[model samples]
Target: MITEESIQQFSKNCENIFTQIRRDVIGQQEVVEGTVIAMIAGGNVLLEGVPGVGKTRLVRTLGRVFDMPFSRIQFTPDLMPADVTGTNIIVKGEDGNSQFQFQPGPIFSNIVLADEINRATPKTQSALLEAMQEHTVTVMGVSRKMKEPFFVLATQNPIEQDGTYPLPEAQMDRFMFNLIVPNPGLDELMAIVNMTQKTMAEVAEPVCSGEELLKMRETANQVPVAEEVMRYAMTLCSATHPNSDCASEAAKKYVRLGASPRAGQALISAAKVKALMNGRFNVAYSDVNALAAPVLRHRMKLNFEAIADRVAPDAIVKMIVEEVGTRFGLNPKKEEAAAKAESKKGLFSGKKA
Candidate 1:
């Protein structure tokens, strides 16, 4: 069971970790927070941005802050499946007999940075789907389990698409959050330059251990969500589906495919963590609304019309949230006022017309 003290401790630990990471990583606070939330939720993250936007730096900073064994795999077209997972190699035994031995690869680490993940071919990208989903790799009919609290933070350069392969849909769904790393503002850029100039970059110290992270996950799971609030999450998810009963007009017009059930699960898990971080014991409607974009952006597929109109997935998700909130009567202040009025009127009294 998670005690109040544990929850408070978890939040404090995460705050310290974030503070340490910020000492190195300059901007993109949303990206950092989304990654941290996904980490606590025990989910994989897909980061998309132009090169030199500090996506890789964010992942590396996170690795240092968590103090976990970190590995970076620079995915390339020629990279094979065996390069990601382990492969069996023949080795000489003490008795001079040759035997096959399984050598672990970079995926065995606690934190893995799949740098330039889209640069790899589909065959190479598929290699990670298993480990991301099941936390295990099966090679040559042998199955090996990864260490506890495994996380894969992948980065892709959006502008350089000539030699890149789009991530397969199956593999895309395996990620919990697909965050867009925006370019830094003027002040942020200045800060970045100053931080890097005339000295070695500061290194993030470990603020918490892997065990403490797992405990934080447990505490986040204990955050209660009201049934109405949960229903709002479900309704928002279904609304992303084109032509569904709950779908918004934009979804029907522009979306080729809606978000998956995994998106709904991500919303709840992330919302719970967000609530705890905000010092709340119960999830509020606002928490789910805040996380809808990162949780749904990659999940929702846009149609040709959307492309022609230059409509981004983020816009469609925002529209869906607005439509769903209205449909589900999610105005908290208004609802609370109505409840107060009802209580004042008494249970059996008839309304005066």
Candidate 2:
């Protein structure tokens, strides 16, 4: 069970993490928060952005903020699966006889930074599927469990299509959140330049350990969800599928493929953490709405019509959210109140006439 004291500690730990991350990251607060939430929820994150937008730097800062072994794999076309998930090598034994020994690769770390992950081939990218989902790497029929608090924070270039391969749907579904890192504003740009001029090195310090992070995840799992709110989350995820019974108009029109079952699991798990972060003891409808985009954007496959009309996934998600909210009467409290007030005004005007 979650106690008040434990909740306070969780919030404090989150605050310390953000404080430390700010020391190295300049802007993109949403991306930072989403990444942290996914980390605490024990899920992988995929960051999409153009070059030089602090995507790699943010991952490095997270490594510093968490007292864990960090490894950076600069993904390229020439990269091979063996380079990522180790292979057995022949080595001399004590008696000078050659024997097969397993050599672990960079994947055997607490936090892995797969920078420019899309640059690698599909075959090489598939190497991470098992590790990301099962948290284990299989080599030569042998499986090795990942260390505690393991996370894969991958970065990719969105605009650069040349020499880059699109992440397969199976691999994409493994991610909990696909955060889009946008360009910094003028003030943020100045701050980043000034900070870098002082030192390019990451100055963030570790505030949480692997054990403590796991504890936080455990605590988040205990945050209660009301039945209505739970059903609403399910409805939102179900509505993403155009063929489903609860399909929204936006989904039927624009989406070619909906999110996988993992998306619903990720939605609730992350919402629990989000509630705890805001000092709430229970999950709310607002939490689900706030997280819908990052959780579903990469998971859904937009049709050619959507692309031809220049309708981005985010826009489709927004329309689906509104439609579903209306269908389920799950709009935010403020919106509900405004709607009631408008109805009352029309009623009074009709009575006066």
Candidate 3:
């Protein structure tokens, strides 16, 4: 049992890890925090960012902080499945007999930085989908268990689409969150320059071992979520469908495919972890609200109208949140009306920086 005292210890350990990571990463605090959340929750993440945003550096710093065997796989179109999951090699034994031994690939590492994951062919990308979801690899018709506390942080170059294989809907749904790493602000950039100019302390150190991390995740799962909160999460996901009476105005017009019931499961699972992270014994409505964007972003699909209208997934999530309202006791129509009014006020107006 993870007691309150251990929870405090986990928080302290995470702070130390963040302290080490911040030394090297001057900006992108949100990205680093999201990565930590996913890792602690035992969920995989897809980081979408433009080039030169230090996505790789974040993963490297994370690997160092967790004190795990980190591996980087530069995904390419020609990459094969065997390359990601190692093949059985014929090793010569000392007894002069040759036998097949499974040599693990990068996917076997505790932390895998799938750099430019979209650049890999679908076949190679499919290889990872199983590992990300099941935390195991099936090679040569044999299933091999992965190391405990395994996590995959995959980065995608949104600007570079050509020659890149797009992840299908099934594969995309495997990710718990799609975090967008934006460019740093002016002050953050200045801090980066100054930090680089000085003889600063190194920004990569392990604060906790793999065993401790697995324990923390187990504890996170144990956090209590009320039946009402679970119902709220379900309503939020279900209301995104256009045909459903619960559909939000934006979802009806812009969304093609609504989120699956797995999203409902993910919402509650993640919300439980989030509550524990926030030092709460029980999950709250605010916890569910805060997680709506990340939970629903990648799971929902945008149609041609949305693509032409430039409606983003975040925008759709926001509409759903407003439609569902912070308090689910009221009728759904009121919130749907509120969502329309917000959009009319140009809710999705600002440029996504």
Candidate 4:
């Protein structure tokens, strides 16, 4: 059970972590917030953008925040499955008995930085799929559980797909958020230069521990998600479909397919955490709308026409949000039940959700 006191503590820790990260990184508050949200939710995030956008810096800063064990795998074409998940080794003991034991690989770390994840071959990439999804790695029929609060922050170069294997859509769906770390603004860039120029920069210390992070994840689970809020998340997912009347014009033109059921599930879960991050106990449609882009960008597949038209998935998501965001009045106190109760007094019943 999560106490109000504990949530206040977690939020303090979150802000402290963000402050330290800001020392090394510049602006892109949204990216930083997305990382923290995913971490608090006990879910992995995929950072997608061009090179040198501070993806590595963000992950590294996050590692220092909790003093969590960090490991970076520079994925490449030659990277192998055994290289990632570890393999058993034959050993001779003093008893003159031959035994095989598994040596844990980088996968055992609490925070894994999968740098240039797309550079790896599909075969090598598959190694992480099981671990990321199940948090367990099987070696020689033996299953080994990963450390608690394990997170995989994978980065990919958007412009350089050559000699790289694109992540499979199925694997992409496993990530909780597909964050885009955009280029810094002029002021942010100036601050970044000044921040990095210091040869002796007093940097982040571990402000929290794995246990504390785990407790926060439990708190996020306790975050209240109303029934209608769940339906709103589902509706957002449904609206992504080209066939849906709610689909935006851009979606109808660009999307040949829509988000999967997992998208809806992720939207609700992430929105709950987001609401809690903003010091709220209940999920809000605004929270869901804010998260729709990051949650759906990697999950939804655009058509060939979209590629030809040079349409970004972010635009489609914005279209959908604008389509559905204001439809539900943004009343802080008039919750789902209250809205429905008031609806009974109206001619249309105000439409449940």
Please name the candidate that would achieve the greatest TM-score relative to the true structure. 2
Candidate that scores best on lDDT:
2
- Alpha carbon lDDT of residue 208, candidate 2? 92
* Candidate 4 lDDT tens digits, 1-353: 76888778766766666667666567777787778888888778999888877898788878887778999999999999999999999899889899987888999999999999999999989899888889999888888999988999999988886899989987898898999988888998887777777753547778788998888778788888888878777877888889986676667888988898878877877776777666578887767777788999888789999899888898888777766655654443334344334324321111211
> Who is ahead in lDDT, 1 or 2?
2
lDDT of 2 at 316: 87
Residue 315 miss distance in model 3 (angstroms): 0.6
The sequence of per-residue lDDT tens digits that candidate 2 reaches over residues 103-130 is 9999999999999999999999999999
Ranking by TM-score: 2, 1, 3, 4
Q: Any runs in candidate 3 off by more than 4 Å, and if so which?
A: 199-202, 326-353
Candidate 2, 241: how far from true, in Å?
0.8
Q: In model 2, how large is the Cα lDDT of residue 191?
A: 98
TM-score of each: 0.92, 0.93, 0.89, 0.88
lDDT of 3 by residue, 1-353 (tens): 65888778666666676677776787665567667777888878889988977888888888888888899999988889999999999999999999999988989999999999999888889999789888889998999999988989999988888999888988888887788999889998888778778854555778778998887788777787788877888889988888887788888899999998778877787777656655577787766766778779999888999999998899889878876774466444554464334323320122111
| lDDT of the structure predicted as candidate 1 | 0.86
Full candidate order by lDDT, most accurate first: 2, 1, 4, 3
| Model 4 ranges off by over 4 Å | 200-202, 243-250, 326-353
Model 3: how large is the Cα RMSD against the reference? Answer: 6.0
Off by over 4 Å in 2: 332-353
**Total clashes for model 4:** 0
